[model samples]
Target: METNNTKMFTEMFSEFENDAEEGQKQKIEEINEILDEMDEAEFYSIFTKEMFEKIDQMIEKKKLTLENAILLLKHIGYHNVIVKFFKFDFHVSSLRFRIENMITEEEKKKEGKNEKPLVDLCECNLLLSNGFISEPIISVCVTYVLKVAMSKEEGEEARKDVEMALLALSNTMYYFIEQKLYLKEIKDIVQYHQEHRNLTRLAYQSVWQFLFCRLLCDRRLEDVILNKLQFEREAIRELEELTKCIDWKKNEDKLKEMEEENLLERWIIALNIYFKEFQIRKKEHVVLIECIVQIYQASRSNYIEICNLCICLLKVILIRKNAEIEDLLKGGAVEAVLEEIQRPTLDDEMVYHILMFFVNASRRLKEEERKEMKRKVFEKLEEEGYEDTIASLFETFDFLNRKYYDELSLDISNYFVNI
Candidate 1:
């Protein structure tokens, strides 16, 4: 079987399909050799310089200046080389200041404390922004250490390295996902990060970093993945686990984990998912219902989530209570949903949703709403109704149509022809 590192490389290469294999292989090999004698970062600078030089030479031959060649290559896809060059090892460009501050803070710990003053952190930051095609570089950077944590011998020190690497990886990936080049890579890293809880700091870092990345990733990714992003999901569960590598003596990391484990984070995730739905269709009222369902099931205990849940619940009651679902049937919305939910051998969960949908139909009732509904039904039945009454019934029925449980069993073949 391929090792975890090999597997990660495979995942990263999944994109850039026509990757000049011979070229990239020769490139990484030549780059690695040069890096071996110098620094891993040398690979990033050298490869970038060499490739761009050659591209510039070619462009210059065509009479284009170096800057124009660079710009044109970016527009025409040679930017992949720069992206690949980042795959080696990415040290945080700004962690020194942050680490120093954190170290100083550690020295001033209130009382008895065991927080290690990050003796030394291998600085790795690849100044990535959300506007470039650098997702693959992110994948390669993060997976380097994760592969070790997942496969190399199990040890505490190795785990800390893994955790730190992952934090930096996740930090970089936020920029990658925002850049919109490699979701397949982000998904892979998320899975790896969630797999085990190493240092409390690392574990919390992975979760926060991932949640942050998810917030920044392609809205389309969440659009399709909304239902599947749950931590309970195997693919996610496999990566979302907390390993035993964290240094809990550091109260900060432990506190961070505790904070993230609460429900407020989930509320944000749910909100993110629903926002994407709204983006796709502005008047998709059904999304409100869907959002509520997700929020209700989310076992979040954070007060912020609870408050948000309360607000969302109020919205649900406002929209759904005393809703007139009858006109919705006539308006074609009800028919559209029934057609999908009425499938044979429906999944149990979906069936439960249908049952609850009807149950909700029975609740949220208002006496005036019912009277108005009855008046509309009678008017529809009476062929003797005046023009005013006819218009009123149409409007009234549409309101009721939103909450009514009546089914529209259009013949399947007729449904196709009518459409």
Candidate 2:
């Protein structure tokens, strides 16, 4: 079987190398002309392995040197050939099935020299302290591996690789952005992440990570003032292309490892990086605030995280003094926070945060929009049979100047320049 397998692949390679277009003399001659001029070594820049063991070894050693392949191709300086290989537009799945079956029969040939047919990413963390271009390409391959896992019906395993690749992609992409300082690509990446509204419950919180990672893609994504974070991707050019990627794997084991060491808080603190680096626009800034609001309002998580989120929102709303915030109250932001506070037996701390959320919301409104909102609130009250409640609430906040100004001592370095 092993001999047969070797013979089969050898035949395929020979056939591919020396294949003819049977009916077309012109086409056959063209292929010949190209092959005749080829530097065999450079053409085999991405060498195929007869043994999966060798490929697995390279991947395990973290020495699957695409460097040599990259260098060899660069030496050949033939972009057309490389482009032609990738641009062939083969459906990945059909080709993958073809490869899988072929690899399977070949694997069965080896006696007692086998492990798992698929490489174990968990056993080997393929991290490289590497370059910008290398990073994105690695991410592209990581995503491919994850797809393979998913196709094998290992969603849990696939998610782990996806997340790993995401982190790698982040490291790589930022390096590229920093190197090129290409504002257009940066913004495009940002917009792509922003447009990915992860409706999955896990995504809402993870969205900020997406923003923080991408912010450093071109311009930094942190805020110095208020020592905060924001996600503004208006600088990237082809965001749709960048963000068209699938979500990273959720490595539950990783989540558990981090949780044991109280690292989850640090994860939340990543938002501070974004808050510090990018100029948080009104809409983007409010998203962080609103995410916190929604999380707490759901009354689903533990008290500690909810409290931390409330406190952060308090600081953000106080510092920003945004005008577009009235829309949140309109969109039930007020109601959500209020619901959290009034949950069966509400505590004083929670109540205090709820009031602060209101105070911040009030400060965020423009005087005119506030009045219109105020008038609408009363109308809404009438519509809802709560006209009496409207009057009381309106009278309560009428004196209502409770917004915060940016602290005078705030350092510009601490805040991201909108550039």
Candidate 3:
């Protein structure tokens, strides 16, 4: 007796082999209806690797239209939510063949053959964009595509393959992290692209976004990414070496120059992840605080999002109380916050966080330290006309009726009172 899956596969294959497009569409729809009614185990039984090989054979023989093939993959991809231990080797291999053939067609087109490839590149991209495909399948496909992309020599053909690979990687990155598949090759490729400046602007942005998503989910990658960005060991070494021979004023200039040399885009990506996904570890507090303060100072005017994230992360650090206030103060956190408030378009959320940072930092300081902090802040405020800045911010917070407006306002006012 044939199982339900075996029976459906028989019918689907029969319909696929038919010459009439309407018959094929009808058969596909009937099979889709059957698949829609089946549960995970049933779907798994019908969509196995052997089944995909059969479909690939049909695809090769020109028996199934690209639309039919894509529809079948779409169903499998959509039902990916329930199936476990999915056998995707055949499908991935088929996809690799399609992509390579598409590139070959692209090269041929340049040489005067206007023939399009049998597979639809856009449909393939859309299929991967479902965001439901399993990591193993995506990993295999991405590995193959990136290998092709990197190995190709400089030419239009290489650029097209690279663009296709980047788009596919971007679409599948969400699943990559969701399924906890951290491919080291992907990390290496993203890092290489960052330095090479070879990809188009859109592709460049896509790969960086892919790295950002991966970093957000994998806590184990934190140190690796930070070290690459020089926010860990290298940053500490540089700071130590700079302090050996320089006064604070000259040190500030040297640090600013060093920070300028680093990529602002990378800093923004790492900081966004640090702010949203994970807390900075205690050991990272000193270096990260210095890094955040410097970047905030460098970007306060031009990059509002980075500045906002910097302030929010600083607030987290202060509330956790893992780092000493002296470290924050000496790292120029106070000056960064002051300069941030001077921005003309400060939102209520930003204002609330900025005030909260001050409130949290001054909470448990010693009396002498409090006095010194107040004197230092007041001098800066007086010199920069930040007295009016604070007052205006207070009025905005008061109008917004933010939950901690009263507490934050009083704490900041008391903390900065002139002696």
**By lDDT, who's the top model here?**
3
Off by over 4 Å in 3: 1-145, 148-182, 187-212, 215-266, 275-295, 298-310, 316-324, 364-367, 384-387, 398-412
lDDT of 3 at 207: 58
Model 3, residue pairs in steric clash: none
Candidate 2: segments with Cα more than 4 A from true spot: 1-160, 167-296, 300-318, 343-419
Candidate 2: what lDDT? 0.36
Query: 2 or 3: which has the higher TM-score?
Result: 3
What range of 10 consecutive residues in model 1 has the weakest lDDT sum? 74-83
lDDT of each: 0.36, 0.36, 0.57
lDDT of 1 by residue, 1-419 (tens): 44443344334333323344344444334333322233334334433434434443443454443233223332212112112234521122222233234444544578864332222211132222222323334444343334432433358776655554444444344453443333454455445544653334433334444544555544555443444444223222222232122222333553344433332333334344333333332223343333333333332232223324423332333334322354332333232233323333334333333334433433443556445543543444244434443343234333343544534222221121222
Off by over 4 Å in 1: 1-161, 172-257, 260-267, 270-306, 309-419
* lDDT tens per residue, model 3, 1-419: 45776677676676678657667777777776665556555655666656766777887888887666766665554334212224434345555456445544554464564222322343253333335444444554554455644543567777755765554555453443443333566556556665675664435544555566666555666665556643344334433343333232224463343322222433344445544554455565667678777666655655565568778767776776656777777677777886776677888888777777676667757779878878777777777586686677657655545555464443336645732
Task: Write one digit per residue (lDDT tens) for candidate 2, span 100-137.
Answer: 44334434465753233322221122222222133333
Q: Estimate each model's TM-score.
A: 0.29, 0.32, 0.49
